[model samples]
Target: MNEEIELKELLQKNKMYQQVLDDIEIGIHVVNAEGKTIFYNKKMMEIESMEMEDVLEKNLLDVFSFAQNGYSTLLEALHKGSSIKNAKQTYYNNKGKEITTINNTFPIIDKGIQIGAVEIARDVTKYERLLRENLFKKGNTKYTFESIIGSSDKIQEVIDTSKRATRTNSSILIIGETGTGKELFAQSIHNGSNRMSKPLVSQNCAALPDSLIEGILFGTRVGAFTGAVERPGLFEQADGGTLLLDEINSMNPTLQAKLLRVIQEKTFRRIGDTKDREVDVRIIATINEDPIDAISKGRLRKDLFYRLSVVSIFIPPLKERKQDIEDLVQFFIDKYNHLFAMNVKSVSSEVWSMLLEYEWPGNVRELEHIIEGSMNLLEHEEILTYSFLPIQFRNKPQFQSERNTKKDLDEMLIQKGRNIKPLEEYMEEAETYYLKKALKHHEFNVTKAAKALGMSRQNLQYRIKKWKISKE
Candidate 1:
């Protein structure tokens, strides 16, 4: 059921409403029944490369033309008193630049009489000549929710959140350090979602250079450049499924703008083609760096970040969830033992101390690699000992993990009188309680509560992600 939004009085404020419309990212064009342009926004001007003086109050047919006798979607909607949803329109602007857009045209009905039409547009170009149905089927994902192995409260909470995310088609941004299983969670989400029947394609944004990645994403047009041929891109192949963009911050900012258009309009332009191609793929981007930091450094566009983080999932690092190390070690041992026909029971006390003390710079992937490397050397030994460890494991870490809280020093002083404990465990409980109170007081508005908490919204968000605070 659709909920009604009260905007009668708000929309009646013409100047304010007009300013809001012009500030929108998507192009908005309004025309009367006679095809005279009544409203044209700033974004529309940018999209069509026309000035406000030339477009407003002018006839739409005079400024632009549908190529090859193509009918106008907006005019058609007005005459037929209907809507043309997700329709592609190709036309030539005054500058002679071929413009292709995905338009949602709707007619305005005043007391059952057709008054005018409005068309929202986004610029897109695409080229295609390849069939990818077979490739889509062959690259189906193997991981599901069950494939993820962890039992810590933080890991379980992240799992629950990911399971809930599978019910929606919204874009997701998974943020974590390298080797934190960001792609593993992405695969699990895809396999559990309604779109599971469709292929789940993966791409490493940094795998190719900028010039080549564009061609890889949107495909190339024949004669686009030397040695260029018509071919489909990942967007075409992943249509009706999911596209997992690993290390999305590594993508060029220029291409990031193009990706934003696709998210907004569900259409994209090919590398060298003028025609726009529509697709229905869900985007899931993973970033190894802090997104706020990425935006500050201009590696990521803020607008793109906003769109991509519709459902943000932050996976805690291995050091943050050290309690799970023992369980993870056992799981990996069982896995490698089965694969290598070894009967290794468990690690020795020395090996266990080394595993728990040393900081996992490579996270879970590093742990699995360590276990696999040890399994190869285990021939007759029933128990994995320190001798089977890697060369770097000879020296144990002397430092403990960080306590990211304001009260770590104060808590340490108090803990000496009671029992010895890491400062993080005590801070986690207090921090979680205070954050919940602040959020509840603000009716769960993160922006307002974050301000009240004397922290940036991103900082508050990180804390919430770490603590797994349920706002809904």
Candidate 2:
């Protein structure tokens, strides 16, 4: 009778433990030493699109055939008593819905004996979908000329020139500073071209090493090297279509020479192949710095520049297009309204004045981030006021400087019966003032603010925390 009572109490404790796991956000699954499903939480059921009745007391290999094939972390942990952390798992469920998750799996040991294995998973399907849409979707354009927000003459001229260039097959080079919407213009040109029905492939020249980039652009034949396999390169895949080369100035000189030959002859050979392969890909390259400066610095070759500059388009920085700031602000407001489910209608006059007066060194990208951050913090207000702006905007450098002039300080001191405070106190006040000013001037961007202040970013962050300064 005592044994039965103890067994019932242990079952109750296990039930309580399972209930606790179900209430948590992460998916959890526990398998016994024999690889049988012993416990599965509610979140696990939701993530896998399965039911409790289907998984309870069933062999994991029977439920997920991949387990028996030695492809599952739980099975591996069960057999090897090993732990796996942050391993990516992608699989298709019974209903044919693809699922992607990051998993941490480990063995459950009790008193020096391996009892079972448990797995914790976090879903990342949505993020993976967004990444695929951005990087690999063919014949799909996410932006066009209509999506370009500004109506300023400088932008309009570039748009017109880009549209004209799309009607031909000549090589085109785009020049602008960072955040000047280079990719946006490139995609627009691709969509507007006669080859819109074909694939539009793109690669960033600065994202990989020279060896990997060569293989990615020109492909490699089977047995080209120790581990190389036959593959189709971007030029061949984009045949009869368009290929966008972003940050072209970052390409090594040797790769640039090969690219020049491909552009001139419309043909390129695989890494280990002797015969040349023909392709009809129209090339569009982008540079975020001046071409002449790049040449002088040996980052780019003059011959390659001449070949790519058959037609060149320049995108003006946001500071030079101040007339478009108001429009761009309104556009971002509407965008966030839809994204964040807010109802912000307009900006206060003071907010507009401050926006116009500020020099947008980071250009349109920075403005978008500022508006998005402000909108995220807004609550129960229809109009965006000065208070809704970030603390950096509220404490601009010009206003702070005017408030700290010697004349104003002397008048304030005189009002205090000509009494002076301790030198330490005055020094602390000055330090606080300058730190805030530097942060505000950089719009609370830690790296840029640190660079402007001649300090490390970690040091700046420490001082900001010490001063109890709020970025929002």
lDDT tens readout by residue for model 2, 343-429: 786676446556765778888998988898889789878778867787775687964555356356556434556568677677566
- Give RMSD to native, each candidate: 26.5, 22.3
What C-alpha lDDT values do all the predictions have? 0.80, 0.80
Question: Which tens-of-lDDT digit does each residue in 1-472 have in candidate 1?
Answer: 1222346554568878898999989999999987789999999888788999888898775577543324578777876888999987766576544467899999998998888999998766332001112222345538788767665668889999999999999999999999889999999999999999997989999899997998999899998999999999999999999999999999999999999999999998887799999999999999999999999999999999999999999999987766567657766776666568777767764475566656788999999899988888889787788778765655444422222232564564466568755667766776677679779989999976754443345456656876899976
Off by over 4 Å in 2: 1-141, 392-396, 399-472
Against the true structure, candidate 2 has what lDDT?
A: 0.80
Regions of candidate 1 where Cα sits further than 4 Å from its true position: 1-141, 396-472
